[model samples]
Target: MDTMRERFASVTSRLLDEDPRLAVVLADIGVDGFAAAARRHPDRVVNVGIREQLLIGVGGGLALTGLRPIMHTFASFLVERPFEQVKLDFGHQGVGGVLVSAGASYDWPSGGFTHMAPGDVALLDTLDDWTVHVPGHPDEAEALLRHAAAAGDDRVYVRLSVQTNSAPRAVDGARFSRLREGRRGVVVAVGPLLDNVLAATEGMDVTVLYATTVRPFDGAALRAATGLADAADVVLVEPYLAGTSTRFANDALADRPHRVLGLGVGRRELRRYGQLDEHLAAHGLDPRGLRERIAGFLTSAARA
Candidate 1:
């Protein structure tokens, strides 16, 4: 699995092997690779072709019957269509299920506006007790999923970006809580955009905090990590137009004092068509744009 999406398949495939209660469902929009995995694990997998709402409802039902259901669908279809099911069957009733939403952000050129999910994070943030995890790469996805299995949570949304992976460095889930400590500035990154951040500042001294889980954000850790910054320049990277992580980070660390610069799609009413790479790049998401943003953020913070 060269990409994070494939890494998710790897981890979920393992989980499927161990737990009979664990079940994976692929939406019609699922990738061919994951569809193959679902094929291999038929007894433990469910496929609802193009029916995201029914797919989510079935997942909720499966979870209600005391089985773990992992539902994979396009981000827009998963959130927009199944909002009622998510709020009612999933969040309101507190059913256990993992909603894996792929094709976040631009949705590539192949998928038009109907598939592009630029506002899923904002939608999920409004739901009570619902947890959202946007891993920038395979390592973080593995760690986050390990955390999900161990803990008993109401809902979890794992976001997958089409970009390359950038989250394998901190993989051990046991030592996961220590990842957001002893840093001058906390560089909060969401989705695969962290890859751009990692690539932009290769071998730099910046501290990166990858919070796959969005709702119960490690508030204390975020504060501690950023509060002590004598030269605080908290940079948040996300792929969404509204940037869920950046908004959450700002609200979370607001009581504490720190300088913040959020780089993402940045409040554009998205056009009907574009490539993920070009779309992100147009909004300062490429490697070069990321460098300029981080550099300017630090430079401006130094002046302040």
Candidate 2:
């Protein structure tokens, strides 16, 4: 069971061999993993020596030449640090490329808050038409990565995390998979939080929806699950910033009278450089914390 980042390096190495149009740009972040790939395709695999902005600029330049570029880095450096480059290089320039990231929200707690990026997705939401994939398992990550690499002129962002579920679900790179059905409410679990969400909602009469590709946000599936009921109650459990997808959910059920509770990393930064599990628990993302919040939200909604 290799981590998603390991799988990314291996799978992407093979992709470089398979697709001549594919190019990978790195900022010295995953250089060791991609060392062999660089040797094999020196012309295509590029390392920008810790320059995050240049990493994105190079990808955009490659995309301008009609090559599908895959940019790799930690989440904070990839999205937050070079956000202006991301906005202008790809979005404003109107080109397509795949941005693959590691070091999710609190993946490396010892790296400290500087490495964490719980607001990455929310930040990207400001842009338009970007395909975002948050894979919960390595297999899903590979599948989504392949899809993004071959997307051919469409802007895609694939967020890779250290956290993963016990198993992988079949991901089509789009649409929400309904894992459990209930009439009381719907709990939408986004990447890596499925196992905890499943545990939290155990035996509860609430629909559980698993989301791997969240940007295009399968609003249709959400509508179908809740049946657009007047008293619909929805809970979104994401690994990134809390309420990141609340607006999307609201737009999805705009016509209906419904309630949505967004759950994920809070605004307050935890200064303690604790373990990953400790971070999850502190943010109320562990099974115990999630159960309390989810149950309370549903119970209160029932009374309403």
Candidate 3:
């Protein structure tokens, strides 16, 4: 199976060949992957080396010159490290660009906390007009990237992670698409968590909704699906930090008193370096762990 990173390189190369206005800016990451693209379009594909700050600055400059800049790097460096650049260079300057991030959350646990960015989306939420796309698989990633590139500088953030669902669904980024129908509760699977969420809710009387886009939150779609039932149990299974969407969920269900569960990576650092599955187990993000927590939560909701 192709990874999100692989799809990204392929799409970016195609964009470079198709759109003369498209320029790719890299901060010493994924440079070798696009060597052919860089060779073909010398003026379009640029590697700025380890300076993420300048990496963003160059993108901002390219945007000013009427070029659509696609910036790539690790999530930590792309979003957190050069946040000021992101804020001012793109936001303050009124220039739009696509910011694609790899090593989502703790995808690079071997690299430790410095390379991780669990709070990237939370940080982006503080800004305006940023479309966050969290695709669950390589196909979804490719589709979302194409959407962003065609969107024309609407301040897009494409988050890529090592975790992936078994396959891609016919996901439309406009709203949350309901995958399963039930009555007891609703489970919103954001990005890569679809597989885990489906496994957790198997044989249960709960609805499942899949989302490739999270920033818009799709409150209207959520309300329509759940009917805004009072005290309805709604669980949000995200790949990033737990409770990140608690506020959004509260806002969506503000009309009624509902029980919400936000399951994902814990806020505290795991500290130990290991494989991705080890980290998932440590955070209780595996299928079994998610099923246990979700099942228990549903039981309690029913009792209440």
Candidate 4:
């Protein structure tokens, strides 16, 4: 499968060539992927080695100067480390830019917790007027990147995860697209967790909703799906922090009382690190773990 980072570099290169307004700022991560783009558009592709704060500040400056800047780096550094820069440089300045981050929650487990950022989305939620896109596949990443670049002064954040699905699906809007129909409940899968979510709910009687753009939480589509399916149980499976979207879901379903199970990376730090699979299993994000959790939740809901 084509990785999301590669697709980001390729699409960004095209954006640089075609749109003079688009610029990319890098922080020594995935710089090689954009080497050719940097060489061609030297002035547009700016690389500030190891300085996450400067990286975002430069992007904000570029945006202020009537140019669309795209910032790239690991999630940990991109959001968590330079949070003040994000809040002040971009948010305070009222300059919109696209901040694209690679490496999902625990994509680099060998690098330990310092390299992992499960609270990125939650942190972004603190700010206003920012659009977040979590694409499940490379194709979706390319599409979202292009859309965000052309959005005209919209502050967008595109999170690219290392894990991907087998193939790409159409993502034209922020609404949830129904993948499977069931009567028991609805399981909304976010980003790269789609395949695992499918496996976990394979034999279960539940409606599966896929979401690539999670931030603007498509309450209308979710409400319509749940209303049509008459499901009061909702299980939001995200790739980031657990219960990250629980509040949004609650607001979406405020018209009716419902049960929700939010699943994702846990808050506790797992000091032990080896492979990505190990970290995923430890967090109950693997296929088997997800299946067990989903089944237990639904079974308990049934009894209730």
Candidate 5:
């Protein structure tokens, strides 16, 4: 199976052919993939060189002219470097566009900290009305990408990662899918970590919720899952920064007594350039590490 990034290039190339209103803006990151698309729609497919801010600015400009622009780049360059442009160009201007990011957290560790973006989702959370999609499989990524491209004046962010699950779930780009039922607690796995989460929680009596679209979080599903329990013990296992969605979970269960444990990439930088698997294990995101943490959290919660 192709990686999400490769699927993105192919799916987007087809989108450009199908939708004339759709435009793609890049910063020389994935220009090679869109070579044919560029040739076909030179006026619509634009690469603004290495200027990250200009990439967003051009997308915003395109949005103003009644075109839905899809901006692409490394996550760090796309969200962190041009954050001000993202806030002003899209949010402040009240225009809509899709911001698609690759190089999730530590996809290319040799590229160093400059390429990783574990905080992209957390940073975007500070803004209002931005829909965030973290697809775990290439199929899901294609579906979400199509949804975002046609969102029509609504701000959207599609987070593409090198990591993916063994199989794709039926994701509608909204709501959480309840994969298991249990009265003890709920384990919400977000993008690329579902397989590990499943392995970690095997034989455990905990509800497993799969989330691809995190913003506009599926509070209703969370509530329903935990409503039957004596106390809600929620564990959020994300691929990005730890505790990124803790606040959202808290708000979702604000009316009741509940506990939430947020797990993901730690704040401390791992300076050593290692393989992706090593990075995941170091962050306690692998199946073995996750089992220890999740088991401990639930066991302790049971005693409480």
Candidate 6:
């Protein structure tokens, strides 16, 4: 898998190559490296200047006209500023276009907090019948794009950050995690935090479930866990607030010993951080933090 930018560009290239009707409508900031992709695919791509609102409008138009459109821009400009257009034109109509949102959670902070979309989930989750996914790694990003394309679902938003393939595929089904063997507990994981969950419980007998489709989660999986199928300590590590994972988990795993201890970003102003590693550290989701949480649980369990 290539970089996030490259993945977006390359996927668009493939789409253009396969279907001449596919077009990449880029806002001002999203057009640098991907312009060549548009140029090569000529008639398939369009750069629509600085209007984020118009970008969605035009993309919505193309989708309605039976053409596939991939809208590219910062998460902020795409969802935050031009929300009216998104809410009315696309979200309401459930337009079938890919929103390749970059810098989903402060990939680089020098661009300022205004550019950071910590609330990208909340902004989009309000809409009905929308498929929202945040890719923790590049391979998942590529595979998810393919999955969405094939799923035939309109109004899908894929959230991406600059990342390598790290998170393990703990969850299996497109609709839910694999209920293949058993579900011990609601071991919740968001994007990058999955790497921590996998590493933390590597050789242990723990059933961990991960999902970028945090909203309208796998209720079947939760219902399955409600019987005698549960581990003692339920832990959820959300990169954002506990709700995105915790609330959803609690709603599913009612009366379960659910505990959420990840950093809550949108709860308040984000710290002036740039590096992803540093951001994770400040938010109590660094590797060290995760290890401590898991190790503490293991030690306590041993004593029990």
The TM-score measured for candidate 6 stands at 0.82
Write model 5 residue lDDT over 257-287, tens digit each, in one string: 9999999999999999999999999999999
How well is each residue in 195-240 modelled by candidate 6, as lDDT tens digits?
7666756665555666666655676665564343445445666655
17-128 in candidate 4: lDDT tens per residue?
A: 9999999999999899999998899999999999999999999999999999999999999999999999999899998999999877989888888889999999999999
Better of 1 and 6 by lDDT: 1
* Model 1 lDDT per residue over 227-293, tens place: 6566556777777754556665677677766666767776765564666667777888888998887
Off by over 4 Å in 1: 31-43, 172-186, 199-207, 270-274
- Candidate 2 regions exceeding 4 Å error are 228-230
Q: Against the unseen true structure, what C-alpha lDDT does each candidate score?
A: 0.70, 0.94, 0.89, 0.90, 0.95, 0.66
lDDT score for residue 112 of model 2: 95
Local distance difference test, candidate 4: 0.90
Q: List the residue pairs that clash in candidate 6.
A: 184-231
What ranking emerges by lDDT with the best candidate at the front?
A: 5, 2, 4, 3, 1, 6
Candidate 3: the clashing residue pairs are none
Q: Encode model 2's per-residue lDDT on 173-227: one tens digit a residue.
A: 8899999988789999999999999999999988999999998999999999998
lDDT tens digits, residue span 193-236, model 3: 89988887899888898989998888877777677334468888
lDDT of 5 at 21: 95
**Model 3 ranges off by over 4 Å:** 228-231
Worst-scoring 10-residue span by lDDT in model 5: 222-231
**TM-scores of all candidate predictions against the true structure:** 0.82, 0.98, 0.97, 0.97, 0.99, 0.82
